[model samples]
Target: MEFALAALFELFESLDQCAPGSRAATLQALQACEGLAPGARIVDFGCGPGPATVALAQAGYAVTAVDRHGPFIETVRRRAAAAGVGDRVTAIVGDMRAPDFADGAFDAVWSEGAAYSVGVPAALAAWRRLLAPAGWLVLSELCWREGARSAEAAAFWQREYPDMGDVTQLEARCAAAGYAVRGGFWLPADAWAAYYGPLEAAVPAVRARHPQAEAQAALDDIGREIALWRRFGGEFGYRFVVAQRG
Candidate 1:
């Protein structure tokens, strides 16, 4: 498990994005967050490499980007500096599940493609205290689309994310967790490609570097995930859900 995790981390270390997302998608979700004036306090939980963090900072939000990985946090700092938003971004290496922040510290809590690390319902419930009254929570989550799912896709997710649910289920979770569902939209296919394209391209080099059995297994898992997406993408996708604290 350690070897596989090391291989996975090394494989993702060089990528500009660690998840399926795009700048346009981030901006679209931000637009749904009404009443957030310029420089509103926002904490980006599980901010992998800080792509969304930089985007929020560029949009004039004072963002505190937190991720468990130290290197990724450093990358966030450098990226923010390069983008001229270093002063606006506070990059911290910390766990999103227990950020240890003051209550009501932020106007918004934003996470893209990372909430599933802690189940969505748990994340929604735990992060609620971090937001001021009526604050917003915007996150993108992997969800089964509302239609026939291929057997291969079903099996893959069952083995991977057995707790995964459809959009309506996610919305119900939001309401049950004390948020009002504002709106949501499915992430476009291009967003997946944006992440997987580079990931697929780098597989050979990563495989060459990690020749151990466990490392190879990790690489194989990544390949299988990409192949499944290519073949059965229509059945499942990431949904960007926008909700506000009640």
Candidate 2:
């Protein structure tokens, strides 16, 4: 289990790209939110390498992109600068389960699939405290209903997000967290196909180039996970969320 997760992390961190294109989806979701204006203060809970961060900054929002990894933070900062939005963006190294921001300091917060690495419920509970009045929160999480948990699926996610719950339960939990669940959209399946498919196919070359590295192994593991999803993705639900603080 630990090996799979470590491999998965290595694969993701090494990629110049990430999917389920949560970055693009989060940007689209945030566009539908209110009170996001020029200079609106926002924080990304687990922003990796600055896709949504770059987008948010490009859209004229004052953005703080946070991730626990120093390399990711540096990547985001460098990318933001190259994109010419560096002055408007801030990249920090911090974890979601224990973020390093002040209470009621941000008007918005964002999270991608990175929330699953920690625990979503705990992250939601902790970070909701940092939001200002009526602040917005956007999430792109992978989930499956409790009843839909097959032995195979359970085994698959047991190492992924063992704490994952269904979409309805997520709605209820967010509601209880003083939030108003606005809406959710199923992520574009074609995007997933495009990303994961090539990633799987890249294994051989990646293996040949760095046989001892975890990247190849992790990509293979994810490919297996994708194959499992192809078989039973119908039983699970993942999406983009827009929620407002109550």
Candidate 3:
């Protein structure tokens, strides 16, 4: 298990960007939320390489970017510095399953394509306690678009993440978790293009560098994921959910 996780992080590091959507998409999500005042303190869980973290920092929020991978944490630090938001961004190496912070430590918790690391339902339940009254939580989760299905896509997601659900279920989960559903939107095709387009283009180079079985499997898995997206993208997408602690 450790070896596989290491190989996964290795693959992640090779890519320039790890998550979907651009800074603009992140800003748009933030803008749609209320209670996220200027200079709000935000905790970015599983913030690989700090794309959204830096963007939030640039938007005048003080961000705490957390990821377990050391290299990704370093990348976040470097990127934050390059973006000149180092003062507002603090990169920390920590496990998302066990965030080390006091209760009500942040005004908002932002996660992009990373909430699945701790399971969406559990993440929603646990992280809600970390927020102050009326605090916001924003996450981008892979969601099943109701009534859209392909055997290939269904099989892939079932193998990769069996706990995935549709937007309505997620909204219900939010309400049950004591949060008011603030609204969310499906990430546009351009967002997937931004993440997978570069990744697909780099697969050959990445595969050639790592010839081990584990590495090859990782590469093939990524390719399969990209292919599945291309074939059944209309059936599902990354949904950005914004909810506030009530």
Candidate 4:
């Protein structure tokens, strides 16, 4: 598990942005938040590289993009500047589990592919305090589609993320945590490709640089992850869950 995390972080840090999908997906996630008012103040929690942060700024929101990695925060600052949204974006280095912000500090809190790092239920509860009344909470989480589970896919995720749940379960959890689910949709297949394709392409070169047995093990683990998605993608995927503080 440590190697898996190290490999994942290494890959993301090497790139300009860490999360998956295109600019369109980012926009779509933002749009899905019915409670997010235009020109709102937002906290992009666990924002890696600020792809979504720049997108949110471009969409007219003032965003504070927070990530624990300094490089990721630097990337956000650079990208935001290049996009001419520097004034609207502030990149901060901090833990997602304990964001350094005052109570009711933001109109919305957005995270993509990062909430799971802190556990969804805990994230929903903790981050809710950062949002104003009726503020939006937009997050993309890995969830199983309703119905029978594919043995291969289920087994893979059991090892990868044992706490993962289905959409119905997530909605109930949100309600229990004092939020209302506005709407949500599963991320399209292209989203997975966007992240994996680049990582897959980089492996050969990266592998050559790492001839050590430990490095090989990490590479193998990453390879298996991509392969599982390729084979059993339909069995599970990310859901762009948009909720509002109640």
lDDT of 3 at 185: 91
Model 4, TM vs. native = 0.93
lDDT of each: 0.93, 0.76, 0.86, 0.84
Higher-TM-score candidate among 3 and 4?
Answer: 3
lDDT by residue (tens digit), candidate 3, 53-152:
9899999999999998889999989988998889999899998887889899999989999989888878888888889889998999889998958888
* Residue 157, model 4: Cα distance from true site in angstroms: 0.7
lDDT of 4 by residue, 79-131 (tens): 99999999999889998787778999999989988989989988888898898
* Candidate 3 runs further than 4 Å off: 1-7
Best lDDT among the predictions, by candidate number: 1
> Each model's TM-score, in the order given?
0.98, 0.85, 0.95, 0.93
lDDT of 4: 0.84
**Residue 119 miss distance in model 2 (angstroms):** 0.6
For each candidate in turn, give its C-alpha RMSD to the true structure in angstroms.
0.7, 3.1, 1.5, 1.9
Most TM-score-accurate candidate: 1
Output the TM-score of candidate 3: 0.95
CA lDDT of 180 in candidate 1? 93
Give, for candidate 3, the lowest lDDT window spanning 10 residues: 1-10
lDDT digits (tens) for residues 1-246 of candidate 1: 988888889888889899999999999999999998878999999998999999999999999999999999999999999999999999998888887899999999999999999988788888999999999999999999978998899999999999999998999999999999899999999999999999999888988988999999989999999999999999999999999998
> For residue 217, what is the lDDT in candidate 1?
92
